[model samples]
Target chain A: MIVSIEKCHHCGACVGSCPKNAIFLNDLVLVFSDECNRCGRCVKLCPVGAITMEAKK
Target chain B: MRKIEKDIVVVGAGPAGSMTAKHAAKKGARVLMIEKRQEIGSPVRCAEGISKHWVEEVGITVNNKWVAREVRGAKIKSPSGHTFLVDEKNAGNEVGWVVDRVLFDKALAADAARAGTEIMVKTSATSLIWENGKIAGVRAQTYGEPIEIRAKCVVGADGYESQVGRWAGIDTSLKADDIDTCYQYRLTGIDYDPDYCEFTLGSAAPGGYVWIFPKDEDTANVGIGVQLSKVKHPADPKMYLDKFIAKRPGLKKGQPLEAVAGAVSICAPLDSVSMDNLVLVGDAARMIDPITGGGISIGCIAGMCAGKVLAKGVKANDLSMNTLQEYETMWRDRLENKQWRNWMAKEKLTTLSDETLDKIVHTFSQYGVEKLSVQDLLAVIKRHHPELVKEFEELI
Candidate 1:
């Protein structure tokens, strides 16, 4: 559930999408943290197609 | 490498996450908040406009450090240059405020930290840790090291760029028509009224509006929003804004201090925002007003609800799908129902022709219908256009 800064517009859409309330826009970057539960709601709901899911390294 | 455990863990550190943490911590829950950025608020993305009364409603403290200017009312201008003033009396007493968004967001995070929530910046969550087919916590990376977080309840506050909720399977997708592309600039040397929020609606931004929210007497946050489906000719927002400014006698000489581009979801609330042990708040849940494109007010309200419900679920040791249902029900009761009505109206409005819009606005003004309800407006439209009644009937 890592965020892609380039795609993000800071609309605050994903901030409310998290059940755990895990999304926040910090300056120019949207940050996701340890509270995320892989709900994938934010990934599917981004208005400008800013969010995506990548496999763990 | 780090391993930590807590009663409630909130992700993203944005308004929703911070608010949730604040409330949950106020209730005596051990709260942990994480962010991928070094600072809480930076690189401003919003139009920086917010309703004035939001402070009292969301129980937020008023801080002069973030507020750029206090607005008295909203003045809406039609396509043909016709204007209508929604004065403070007709509108709300204090309509809104133009803010320094970065400062505002940092204040929120600071509030949460002051409430006893541990905030970790420059941290990222990679995936959810599952246990018995339900989310147990998150696997995250701080700096370059791996860390595992285990908590009874987890929250996603990650913003429009959220993947945490999607990973949990809530179907947070938006249609092209349901979303808006926005562009904004922090302009200085602009001589505009600092007490009024101005909106120019119609051809300038089909299916959306252009706004000038004052930051001060000499500066303002100027922006425009357009529905993705109505975007033709690939026009840039800043270009349109500059052209508009050039035409205005007062703003032709202003200097742009910064540029911002973003998008907003004017869609209705989602069918669900809760999973077994996870909850989606703010933009992830799609709890935004379709007409105004405002979410901070609703997001904070929803966060309060999520925080309270989640705390109860954790206390009962019942952070399961059934238990988390309370979060969704509470949110709907508080805001989703109203947001859905607005979305329906937005759908009807988007399909309207320019002439029809002009006629409607003219008729409303002529009828002296200064105080209008969304439901009443939709009813009026349906009565006159029966053939299109089906489109707007749901609004009633």
Candidate 2:
């Protein structure tokens, strides 16, 4: 998952909604860690559409 | 790395943190409040609406700088557009102020500072500092520099995304059904009644509702909350709110000035909020009203209770869970029953069909129910539509 710095409001919706507890908002930066299973709970719950799925290289 | 010592250390610096610090400091416990953000309140996330009664209860004077508009009443509409007005004079604290949350947060933090609490900005708590396998303080950082704060009491006043409680071995988990994913826009150039806050309920926002809180006659905070369980698409909350606004004649033409989003916990009150030297308050404690999804007033009240209890425990030199249990009992005695009642009602209400909502609202408009609340609605239903009362009685 990718968090868009420009669009994200940093409100913690995605951080709280992630079932795996894998998301964290470090000040202005929204961090998605490897603990995220791509269940996409954060994607649906993200208020600003800041998070999107990316092909894991 | 720097080391600091205080009688109390509060994390988050929001209303709950500041209130705890303010009251604890006032009672002579040294207090320090830390915020990860450089500014106390910005990039506003709340709907920014609150009842005024808690201000006086929390001993905060009404300050115009933070009050955007003093609403006189609330106008509720069902899916079919049937409207019911609940006037403040008659409804008591049902409707009050549409505030500037940024200014309000700053004011609370300032109040804490004035009460002799030390406040640090750009600091974040990384973990709990443990001693003898029990909580002692916080492992934190200022900007990028690590620091350890050793305190007798630690407060988890962090909001929805809080980790402080989890770090303390407190369970703060939520089911998807218990969370509300919200999106809002501060829209200007709309014709709005500055005196009345408005709400639209039913399938427009499944398992939740849309609200319009006027900042002024020409501007308003228009928002929608969709139950996380009901969201089936990416960005469903924003989509739902946009579609709702696009259909309203006056709202459709409004231009966006700001955007806000956050998750509101609409679950039952936690089983406990205190453990040993640690206690959680505000959203961390799940002090929000499940039906309204409003937290400011209730959270402030919880903060006041927390502040009093923690300070007393500190002064007694016993930070054990038994001592902290006083806080648990006090807050639960005052807030738990109501929170549970509302949670139960919300469960039943969310399962209701759009036609049921239209009918219920239509009846409310016709019968002229003096106030609108879960208890009041149930009472009215018992008096008039006795048969329908059973649908709600099963839970309450």
Candidate 3:
């Protein structure tokens, strides 16, 4: 998952919505760690449409 | 590689930051306000309703340009459809206008710039600058370029995810119950009372409420805020909102124009909002109304207080905790009691069953009580529903 820094208002709606708790905010940056299962819960919960699932690298 | 200096640096050019910069610059303090987004207010996240009283109090004139609609009152509906309507004049600060948030935010930032405050957009503050264990400034990315801004005083107005507060060691984390996951749709072609804002309570929005704030004769911001802690199963506020719209015939007729989602902090103000040369304002300080989730007016009020205190501190060459504490004291004096009361009301409100909510609405309607206060609510319960008085006695 990728969070567009420009679109994110840093509300952290995605942080709490992540069931795996893989999403965390560090200094206003939304970081999705290795634990993320791509459930895409954060994407639907994000109010600003800042989060998107990127093809796995 | 660029380094800039100012007397005060304000992060986030939302209402709070602009107001803070405006006041500080008006007081002759050199202020720089920055916004991470390219525009001052884009991808609007608010319900956009603000009281006319505070708008005037903050010295901003309410004109037609940004005032989308002026509501005569608010309507509260229970799950069973029992309704109570409060007149605007009697509703105190909760009743007023639904604004164009983008224009309103731009106007505030313009005011700050007019007051000689330097403004920057597309600048993201990634970290705080600490000098000798005292807060000094921010390290930021401006237009994808690294830059450092050092200031005598720093104001963190960075909305709900306030990293500045966390970096400054002010615990900004919220309990699950203290937050609302919200989703809103700006719907046009809707049939709604243009003169009234409407709220629906009960299972439609568990632990929170659904609101229809009319923006025009045929358009409204239809939104729902669900308490994160109260959500079960899927735990998605959007799903709840979809269900709400699907059930309402009037809403079902409306065409969605834009969608917005965000989180709101519905907690009491932080225990402490200031440290050495650092202060937190707006949503960063959790200035949102616990029940209503309205923060524009409160955020502006707090911003003004911060600006005044920051200016004083800058003039005295004392940006220490002692001086910045005045901002905290001023905000608490102005808003703390009301915030705490609302938080208590929210705590109790979340526990009520839909049946009880229907009964409460029915009771209020029977007693001709539309606007609710702790005292008024207790009085009504004591008179008509005495059995519940013990449960709510603590509110009195």
Query: What's the TM-score of every candidate structure?
Result: 0.84, 0.96, 0.91
**Pairs with steric clashes in candidate 2:** none
Q: Which candidate is the best by lDDT?
A: 2
Query: Which is the better candidate, 1 or 3, if ranked by lDDT?
Result: 3
The superposed Cα distance between candidate 3 and the true structure at residue A37, in angstroms, equals 13
lDDT of 2 by residue, B1-396 (tens): 689999889999888888888888889888989998889987698888888666898978789999999999888899999997888745787678999989999999999999999999999999999999888999999988999999998999988888888888788888988999999999999977878889899999999999999899899999999998998887888989999988988989999998888899999999878898999999988788999999887788888888888789888998898788888888888889889999999988898888888877777777777556677777776777777678897653
Classified by CAPRI criteria, candidate 3 counts as: acceptable
Question: Candidate 1: global Cα-lDDT?
Answer: 0.76
Superposed Cα deviation of residue A31, candidate 3 (Å): 3.1
* Residue lDDT tens for model 3, B338-393: 99988988998899999988888888777876445777767877888887667777
State, as a TM-score between 0 and 1, how close model 1 is to the true structure.
0.84
- Measured with C-alpha atoms, the lDDT of residue B355 in candidate 3 is 91
TM-score of chain B of each: 0.93, 0.98, 0.97
Worst 10 residues of 1 chain B by lDDT: B363-372
Q: What is the lDDT of candidate 3?
A: 0.85
Clashes of 1: 55
Which runs of model 1 end up more than 4 angstroms from their true locations? A1-57, B233-235, B364-372, B376-393
- How would you order the candidates by lDDT, starting with the best? 2, 3, 1
Clash-forming residue pairs, model 3 = A47-B261
